[model samples]
Target: MSRSGVAMSRRTRLDSELVRRGLARSREQAVAAITAGRVLVGGIPATKAATVVDGSTSIAVTKGDDPGYASRGAHKLLGAFEAFGVPAPGPEPGPGAEIPRSTGPTLVVAGRRCLDVGASTGGFTDVLLRYGAGTVVAVDVGYGQLLWRLRCDPRVRVLDRTNARNLTPAEIGDRVDLVVGDLSFISLALVLPALRACAVPDADFVLLVKPQFEVGRERLGPGGVVRDTALHAEAVHDVAASAAMLDLGVRGVTASPLPGPAGNVEYLLWLAAGAPPLDADVLAGAIAAGPAGPGRRA
Candidate 1:
């Protein structure tokens, strides 16, 4: 404040001021420095790292470090976006669309009886509803873990403690137009059969591919991670091949924008019932890029 020869403005927490001023490298770094007792404010040491500060505050960092994602698996999805050319999710321009133009355009799940095989916390289900799906039958083995926001939504019908393999057309009482899955502890091969049973000709399929599950237990690295790129490729191919055999056309393959827990990379395979098979090489290349990663317009 003295530098400006004006009354030193009310002081502020150094880290907050830095972030507010776009001076600090990152919020994580600011917090880390404050936690490490390396940040000073107004020529005095600050105690709590998250303390608030003002524009006049002076700060210094004692070290350098890398900031991390909400989850480490974010990097895998980031890799997918880099490889694929799918548009990143962003704010859509203008008004009048039933679906808000922003927050990523909804994939056509609306008015179509749909199923989310592994609807944990309902991320996909959330996306499905945003797209104006008539109803989403969200099935998961776990109980009461869906996001509260989705559970309260009228469009969703939660089916906890249900196994996808056990689902039948009779239970739904109607055929499904789209069946999206994100299962764990089971291979897509096992789940595909049940989905086939539920779909009519011309139905759409979107399932997640986790190399950790598709590959043999032996190939999994420490902590149940699958780090091999080649194995990742094989897992995608195996799922697509199985779908092809079921007479489900492999429409497209993309990476999820969000990574799975335990940092395992995941994939999204789009399929259509009764559609012709896709060329293997083309399909593989599309997945190698961000199938569901960046470039997705919101």
Candidate 2:
């Protein structure tokens, strides 16, 4: 049989194969597992969900669940908390239990009303809740994408089909104490002003900075990945500048612990309302000390 024919004969997409073998509950879960570096095929880490393999190939999930989060995006926020020294509160406190206090200017999620933009699958929202957010307003432009458990959680207010760019304080009901976002297909510049309007004077932010979306299409590498280190730096700088224009201080910048789906290295940007931007040298040092990976140019 020809190569195409052979591929069509018994080969299956890795996500489908994972579902067929009962390794994943659905193709979405399988893709999450694959991109999170948890799925291995014949002892090799699978990089793409659409990779085709023969029927007899061995496939396994290195971890049974998505590390207890609703989606892999939770890991990104969790990593930011650790990297920035933001304290996450423990489980619901008993009558005499005390909430942990933040050591620095890093935002503490405990007891804070938060806003989660681009809250698809409720991953960031889940992280907020896990860290003891008093309440979370989950907003997404798309409808019906949040997880059922999050939608049912009393603390999460679902705002499906809502555009973050047009959000107002009246719409959000009250000013938020903190904001977390993981937006795609749009620049954070367009939404930062709106987020600023919806937050309190000293509210902090932890937003995922996706270079693939920030950089122009002409700069993207194959599969829409931002492979140039200078472009990565430019993207981060642009976002920081935009935040500065809004009077939101750039608290810190760090590379994401996990790469994007197309193997692009993403970044986490920490900001606070009405604070001064970090020193350029300090920001550069933080980026250098962050997790390094394949696409980082020397």
TM agreement with the true structure for every prediction: 0.63, 0.72
Displacement of the residue 31 alpha carbon in candidate 2, Å: 19
**What is the C-alpha lDDT profile of model 1 across 103-160, one tens digit per residue?**
3222355477888887777756765564467888888889997878778888778889
Question: Highest lDDT: which candidate?
Answer: 2
Which pairs of residues collide in model 2? none
Model 1, position 19: C-alpha lDDT score: 65
Going through the candidates in the order shown, the clash numbers are 23, 0
Q: What is the lDDT of residue 223 in candidate 2?
A: 87
Worst 10 residues of 2 by lDDT: 289-298
- Candidate 2, residue 161: the lDDT equals 94
lDDT of 2 by residue, 1-298 (tens): 7766654448767877888889888655675676557888899676655567777898878965564677878767766775566543433457985654544455577899999999999989998887789999999999999999999999999999999999999988999999999999999999999999999988988899998999889989988988787788888889989999988877667777667888888888888866666566655665664443111211
> Quick one: how many clashes does candidate 1 have?
23
Best TM-score among the predictions, by candidate number:
2
**Model 2 segments more than 4 A misplaced:** 1-67, 91-104, 290-298
What is the C-alpha local distance difference test score of each model? 0.64, 0.79
Error of 2 at 243 (Å): 0.7
